[model samples]
Target: MSESGSSNWAIEATDLYRRYGTLEVLKGVSIRLQRGKMVAIVGKSGSGKSTLLHILGTLDTPDTGTVSVCDVPILNLSSTALSSLRSKHLGFVFQFHHLLPEFTALENIAMPSLITGKSKREAFNRANDILGYLQLSDRASHKPNQLSGGEQQRVAIGRALMNEPDIILADEPSGNLDTETSIQVHQLLRRITTEMGKSLIIVTHNNDLAALSDEIYEMKDGMLFRSEG
Candidate 1:
């Protein structure tokens, strides 16, 4: 399957395992996510959900496993190749907004494009388009500190979308927001998959929010189990 490109899967993983010292975090976990769908992973704080997400996002390596993103095998790629692949195909959102303090929301959103050598005019043009899409056109000139928590997260989401990634992996994306704001973020995430046709996998603890996903999984004892109704 590693060499096959005909499959419609956005991400496919098999026999994923990871460890730290004597502790095993992931135990032979595997998953396949389709395009334009959303999957939610729910687990306790110490569970391996975040570790699995990091591995899937190529931010961390597994002790043993194979991962293919957009049908490209990832395990054996060189660091430079991996970084390039990650930047081109994957987007990430974390609990904290992680926006740069000095840059305006527009600049932060344009940073990824700039790093990839896009001209400022091209980058900012796309950034403005994204700001409009995110309904934050007025906040583009505001810095992270000036925006509300939800707005800051929306800026981070805009930054993620700037690269036009195939899949989005979010780790507690709404973890720090109030209930209403979290609900808005959750709805926006759902929209990303449904309206924008991007695959989404989110690691979150909120069961109510998890219920909104197309698929749900639970992590426990370093193992992943599909949740059933």
Candidate 2:
């Protein structure tokens, strides 16, 4: 869409359109996300930022146009194939830390690997590695209700990263946290992108977090515009 070379892109969407009955949410939106870079999408409510995220994350399909990840078109994949692809390549975080209430933090983080057919032992090992990276090793046995808000969010991020996904999609990852916690979460996200070389695409309304990204784009009226350096 921007005349960018396709080789550099981890996710690409072209002429994407979406509709909810009489309301058209996305109108010819296109984006090119480069590998190992963090891009932030910001907009007011009802601007279609979340819709774009769902499409890119393979959770939903566009009504028209194409969406691809690492040059693989996902729009037409079988449900099983899409599920496998999402499990192996894409990670997602939401505003709410959706950890299973009955599971410990470690178990929660290990769920993705388990769902992907890894042995329980193997999954827990990988989960341990990510929890340690996020400085949550001490809280491994704690359930979601037993951990602090920041710790729970960290666990959620750990779960998303458990499978070594190529891209991470976060929608208002710190929306429920206080200002200080949100700042810490933002820094953690930046560190992950920089140190792990993981591509991150985040949809958020917080300017501070957006400013920390490698690129920032604004969504308005179903269109995107470059917002800042």
| True-structure lDDT of candidate 1 | 0.92
Q: Write the per-residue lDDT of candidate 2 for residues 1-229, one digit (tens) a residue.
A: 1125546788999999999998988999999989889999999989999999999999999999899887789967999989888887899999999899999999999998887677999898889999999999999999999998999999999999998888999999999999999888888988998899888999888988899999999998888889864
Q: Candidates' TM-scores? A: 0.96, 0.95
Q: Any residue pairs clashing in model 1, and if so which?
A: none
- Runs in model 2 with CA error above 4 Å? 1-6
Give the 10-residue window scoring lowest on summed lDDT in candidate 2: 1-10
Give the top-scoring candidate (lDDT).
1
What candidate 1 gets wrong by more than 4 Å, as runs, is 1-5
lDDT of residue 33 for candidate 2: 89
